[model samples]
Target chain A: MSAPLVIIAVAIAVAFVLALWSRAHKRMDLEQWAVAGRGFGALFVFLLLAGEIYTTFTFLGGSGWAYGTGGPAAYILAYGAVAYVLSYFLLPPIWRYAKARNLLSQPDFFTAQFDSRLLGALVAIVGVIALVPYLQSQMTGLGLIVQMASYGRLPEAWAIAIAMLVLALYVTLSGVHGTAWTAVLKDLAILAVVVAVGILLPARVGGLHAMFTSIAHLRPGFLQLGAKGMGVPWFISTVALTGLGFYMWPHAFGAVYTAKNERVFRRNATFLPLYQLILLFVFFAGFAAILIVPGLKNSNLALLAAVEHVFPAWAVGVIGGAGVLTAMVPGSLMLMTAGTLVAENLYRPLRPNAGAGEVQTVARVVVWLVAAVTFLFSIHSNAAIVALLLMGYNFVTQFFPSVFLCVWRRAWVTLPGAACGILVGVLLVAYFALTDHTIVAGLNSGFIALAANFVVTLLVSAATRSWDMRRTALRAADIPVHRAGEYDA
Target chain B: MSIRALALIPVLCIFVGVVFANRTYPIVLGMPFLFFYMVVCIVFTSLVMAIVYACDPANRKEE
Candidate 1:
């Protein structure tokens, strides 16, 4: 067996053991399985929050964009910094609300706050649909990493199947506990691998400055956004849209439920942006690849190709092992969130008599089912990793206005209004995707959809208020009038 | 001014500053001008959030 494949195998074994070990002697319940019983402190919460930043997407897609799209790739860095800034204000109220109501899933927040099971179910459906492509992207990234690292000895399909089986095993066995524990190891490995490759690869071409200069010299416009489609307007709109949408993903939104207190989020918001600097190294690795391994057909392979060009077989094995962890940790979290959303929001509402134990069982079963479905899609899919993630973001971002209103002190939006707004936003996103018109007049179609959603929500709520007030008055009049100071108690 | 409003600094830097910084010439710290600008914005985001954390009465509350 190749050294890299052997190393990857050992890494997977160790991660699996660590994941199972996290559940040692602990009882598993619906609450424990979903949000680690809402007891994680700042450090674990930080890891979970930062988990969004360093997925297989960052390891592969971030670099791939830098290698392929050049200047537009900086949008990844810009959006993340802005997101962290927003999270400072956004997450605390959410954490407080979730804790007070014991909400375990993202849809639980909507259901409880809006007082509508139908809205909750609609959200759960949208969350799962958005998550499928994201989960598929991670699985596809894992397959590509393993195949490349194994020197083609392990086919992409087999790699995805094996990794997914391991993911399902750990997630079902230990739940969110497994995802958090494995994230610690994944963070360390990714940090070391990214820094090493970012610095070492550039040295081969006379350092970072020389690397950029050579690329710029060869391709003058390579380091800047394109003139027509991906110009300044596209960059601004994408950055704004995605920054607002970053925490809307079901996994990211549900992660707030794991925190012990609101302070965990406040602390995380402060430090997470520093962690965003790591993407610079990811971009560095991609830029170095442009100099060393130019003209790669599938630019997603840029990071791996660059590593293979310079590093020895054993080093490649180490990088591959880290890459595998990057995929598995995030993939497991996504699976866990998708399963919980299905069980709690979708299934439980339909069968209101179901017990917590039964619901937990269903969630566990759904984890395996989701893993299998995404694995199939990952193998057959050819969409870019970043593009898939963006599509997911578009769908989930539609939840922003509803979520914002739910958290406000006043109930600014009625249930019907919230429902209609999300439905309109989601439908518009679908239309944009089907028509291949993501950029409308230099603005991201998702941003445009969000604007339309906001307008519709307010207009509907205003129109419904007077009608609702009159109905309440009529119902009040129909009731028997109470005597003034009845009984004088 | 409310300390919470300081958060807008990073937002504006990223969304607005990038327009002016999108150039290959005038490399700063061995990186393209745009990339360097992003790095600066990231560091500044941490600093701004830290200041807000220090000033906010919410964080001062006892756990």
Candidate 2:
């Protein structure tokens, strides 16, 4: 076999082995499938959250943004660190609440807290919409990696189809456990590749200092944010919007639910920033790429292009394997989250009498369904990875106000008020995104919409004085129940 | 102030103050000032969180 073929085969084999291994010593149930029975300790939760956060977007898209846009890409680094700080305070209470109530998903939190199945269904709908693009972008990145790694010998579409199939099968079988096991391998591969390429490429073209000097010479505003483009205001606003919105992703919230305890969740939050330091190396790789390989049409290919230029075929294969996992691990988790949202929150609530077996059956079916849809969508996708991420973030961030308020304990934000606020916030986000209009100077359009959401939520809550909802929320917060076994089918 | 509240001071500073260190002057360890500043904020965040965890009542209860 050729060099690319050898590399691709080795990487795929490792990923398959990891996936199959994750299913070992685990029972098949909704609790096991959805949230891993809420038994994950700090280290497992840390790796799982790391896997969920640093997707193909971080590997390909982070480098891609650094290569394509230059300074604005700094926002990528800023947001994760800020989100970690937020999570320190945000997650423990949530874990406490979730573990107490046996809440399996983000929508379950909303449903039980507000006593509104409609609210739960609404969250499910919005979450599915937000997550599909995220899922598709990973497919897009995987397609690019496979096609590029194979020296264009393999078609992008076929690569995506195979990845989608593999992702769906593992997710249907092992759920979060499978994603976590693959993550351990994926994270190791990514850290090694990112550090090696980050240092190697820069040294090849002189040194880190020399590479930046040359990039500064070629592209004057490349190393720092310029007054003319992506100014301080834009950077600050984007970081803030993204930071606040970070854990609002339903899949991320689901990961938080998997933590063994409040203390474990808190510790993971405290330590996650260390994991984020890996992106700096990724940025270095992108900075190196601009000088080493120029005139690439798709900026997303910057890392691959640089690797191909600098590394041997064998090393490139290793990085390619890592790259494929970066996409697949997160892609499978997304399929699981979106699938659970549809079956558990959307259908189960409506049916009201569905057995656990029936619910699990629906979830498995939906997993395949989601993968197929994302597969078809990504085949025709033209959006860049960074653009897809930001677009998804814009919509998902609208949930921040409602979720934060729900967790804060003192806030009496009513169910109807939350419903209205979410509708308005989502509409504003859609309108601004569709029009490509800058509603406020120096700020992300999403931030403006989020502010509007908070204001609307506060006003509606105060006006109606939702005393009954307040009582419901307070009661919901206090349910410190022991972990219950799986609901009988 | 309590340790929990104190921990947020640096986080507020990083988000509101240090983020504007956007200028490329005084590059430290091959990173721009803004980049260096962000890294500091991240490290600072970890430290503060460590402090909060140390002081947390939950830890005390376990002990």
Candidate 3:
């Protein structure tokens, strides 16, 4: 085996062992497996949330956008910081509700709050649909990284299959604990590699200053948002839409339930933006690639190609290992969350009498099942799944209005209203995504869909709301909405 | 101003300010003007949140 392949093999082995090590002496009950028994301290919660930020997408696509689309790439940085700000208020109520109710999955939040199992099932189906494509994307990204870093010594198919097996093994054995432990390794490795490449790659051509200067000379106005397609309006709307929708993903939403206390979120909100600055280095790597390795048809390969150009085989292996961990950490979390959603929300509602042990068994089985399906899609290169992945963010964003409403003192929207609203939002997203009109009238199609969803939800709630809801509303109004002492414990 | 309202400053700087800052000329700190502005806004977001966290009574340690 080549030196790079050997190093990658060792890294994957270490990550797998660490994932199993996290399961030492702990019971893998359904609660423990799904949300780490809601016992993670501030540090673990911080790492888990931060782990969501630097996925295979950020590792490659962030830089890819910088190479191909230029100024539009900065939206990645803008959305996360804004999302953190929103989370400071949004997540505390959610964590409190989930903690009180012992909720395990995102759909549980909808089910409990709205008193509708149908809504829960709807969300479960949507979450699983949105998540499978996401998982396949991670697998696809891992395949690309291993194939490139190994100099084609390792085929993408074998690489994906190996990763899927390891991910399934650890996720089934160790659950969310496995994801958290592996996240520790992933964050450190990606941080080191991003900083190293972000700095050294630029120095090869010139310094950061000289590199941007050269890019400006090569592609004038590349650093600014364009006047037509990706103009200022598109930039603003896309950033707002993504920022609002960041935490709505089922995995991200479910991750909040693992926090030990509400204050963990407040603290995370404070420092997470500082952590987001790491992407600046990622963009630096992409910009450096533009000047160093020009004329790459596949812009996603920009970062890996640049690394291969400048570094030795062993260095490429190290980066590839980091890349693989990036895929595995999130991929495991996604698979676990999807499984729990199916078993807990979808199957449990149907069986009703299923014991906790039975649910855990079903969840584990579903994890492997999802892993197998996404693996097949990744290898087959299914056109439909690829298209679904394109609108995955928009699909998840449809949940935001209902989530925001559900967390209110007494949710105003009735269950029918919430269900109908989400259905409309999702249908609009499907229409826009299928028609290939992601931007309509210079605004993100998702943003427009969300606005329409909000209007329809309100109108329907106003029509469908009954007398009991009004009574509840009146009682809720008597209590102050923002009680400073309520969450202090 | 309420601490929650104070949070809106970072939101505005990111969502609204990016429009006017979309220029490539006169690179600051080796970054294009737009990128430099975003980096500053990202740093500013943390600082603002830090202030919010410190001032909010709900975050105070209880006896």
Best by lDDT: 1
lDDT of candidate 2 over A18-129, digit per residue (tens): 6666567553333343345366565654544444446888888999888888777878877877887788788888888888998988888887777677888888888987
TM-score of each: 0.89, 0.88, 0.88
Candidate 3: list runs displaced more than 4 Å. Answer: A26-53, A153-159, A380-390, A409-411, A467-489, B61-63
lDDT of 1 by residue, A99-151 (tens): 88889778888877765567888999999888887888788778887788668
Which ranges in model 1 have alpha carbons more than 4 Å from their true place? A26-52, A153-155, A467-489, B61-63
Task: Report the CAPRI category for model 1.
Answer: medium
- Residue A284's lDDT within candidate 3 is 93
| TM-score winner, 1 or 2 | 1
Recovered native contacts, candidate 3: 0.82
After superposing candidate 2, which stretches have Cα over 4 Å from the reference? A24-53, A173-179, A227-229, A409-411, A437-440, A466-489, B56-58
lDDT of 3: 0.80
Which pairs clash (backbone N, Cα, C closer than 3 Å) in model 1? none
DockQ of 3: 0.75
TM-score of 2: 0.88
Candidate 2 lDDT tens digits, B1-63: 566786676667666864567766666777766777778878777778877878877667651
User: Number of backbone collisions per candidate, in order?
Assistant: 0, 0, 0
